[model samples]
Target: MSEMQDYRSSLSDPKSRKFETFSYLPEMTQDNIYKQVKYIVSRGWNPAIEHTEPEQAFNHYWYMWKLPMFGEADVDKILAEADACHKAHPNHHIRLVAYDNYKQSQGAAMVIYRGPIKV
Candidate 1:
């Protein structure tokens, strides 16, 4: 059997930025994002969108795109809201979040857009 790679050796650059759980992986395609949204919907979690400047992503509060989409089942509507938020704040980072009412906490969260890297 081949040896497993060391996780420590694959550490990301400290200066480089990361957002939420999906950032460690390769950039997600539209289909991949849709799948994730569908999964959240399947789990009966409420979907919400938030945006903030990349610089403030770590410590600042994100402005919600609108109210949490409680009982929303349409994945397309979720994506459309995300798209509208991006159009409104093209320079801000956008993220999709799922609130678990049963658990009284967040069920899932992922960055859907990374703002242009400021030099």
Candidate 2:
């Protein structure tokens, strides 16, 4: 198979409107969400949960609610909070962002799980 393309660069919108990467999921479940969070934590990166409102769909910035600086031990708590956020904002866009504390830059993985697009 041919190599996958990095479409982020081809986006016509401003860089602010683009997601961290194309590694986003159309839907997110508890099992998969936990697994992704666990994997991110295992890599020694800090996990932060962010969400955007319908009015802010094009907003480049997301509001961070739950940020667990702990390691794998905090997986359950982080996942629990994520679940809560999803439940509360069933129609909003939610995502898990992993940041490298040492590098102070966002990791390549930006897992997004959101409800069906309106319109």
Candidate 3:
């Protein structure tokens, strides 16, 4: 199995979920999404192409219907959508993550935070 699948399989236990990490490129540009899809497909994940709005791209394998973050975008809208969707698809829990691609100039190359939410 590829590295991504191996890593994801290792995370099979939800309670064991640790700090999620990934190398996301400059937002969800078409190119970046394509690359993400490639990684998914290579991992033997057949993602659903029947995408609806808000959840621009989705994969049942990851239990996530991602709403891509464009350049200089606010994640509040996406987070709200995920919250609503989370209620509808309780079995497939959703989480929101942001990618600040070119924000390296902000001197905030990487960030980590902790908080409690009723997931």
Candidate 4:
């Protein structure tokens, strides 16, 4: 628990290269999102995360995230999280683009941000 908190606290550090961003796409889903998440993960950076519009998030017509890509080693965990998003919201078809914190894939990384938020 403390370790996670430490990592979160470290993000606010100005010197830290953990910059975060988002893309509001309305027609996005797991199918299209896989690539983007894969790409970010491949870059060895974990994008930030945000769940804004809690009510409409992954339900109506919106999706939000914070891309805080720190490094390339966190791809595996991130990819799993992305995969979980699809399973969690299979009906809503919400895609999860993220900066992974673990890596366990091929040297060929993937990048394509398209999910339930946009086309």
Which structure among the candidates has the greatest TM-score?
1
Error in Å for residue 51 of model 3:
14
**Per-residue C-alpha lDDT of model 3 across residues 43-112, encoded as one tens digit per residue:** 3332321122222112333433543433312234433454565555544433333333344221111111
What's the lDDT of the predicted structure labeled candidate 2?
A: 0.65
Clashes of each: 0, 0, 0, 32
Q: Which of 2 and 3 is ahead in lDDT?
A: 2
Which model, 3 or 4, shows the larger lDDT? 4
Off by over 4 Å in 2: 1-30, 67-72
Q: Per-residue alpha-carbon lDDT of model 1 for 6-82, expressed as tens digits?
A: 43321244336767768878899999999999999999999999999877788769999989999999999999999
For residues 18-103, write the lDDT of model 2, one tens digit per residue.
44445333445567667777778777887777887745655678777656444545788777777788888887767777788889
Question: Where does candidate 1 have its weakest 10-residue lDDT segment?
Answer: 6-15
TM-score-sorted candidate list, best first:
1, 2, 3, 4
Please identify model 1 stretches exceeding 4 Å from their true place. Answer: 1-15
> What's the residue-level lDDT of 34 in candidate 1?
99
The TM-score values for the models, in the order shown, are 0.87, 0.66, 0.32, 0.31
The TM-score between candidate 1 and the true structure equals: 0.87
RMSD of 2: 4.7
lDDT for predicted candidate 4 compared with the true structure: 0.41
**Each candidate's root-mean-square deviation in Å?**
3.3, 4.7, 13.8, 14.3
Q: Which model scores highest in lDDT?
A: 1
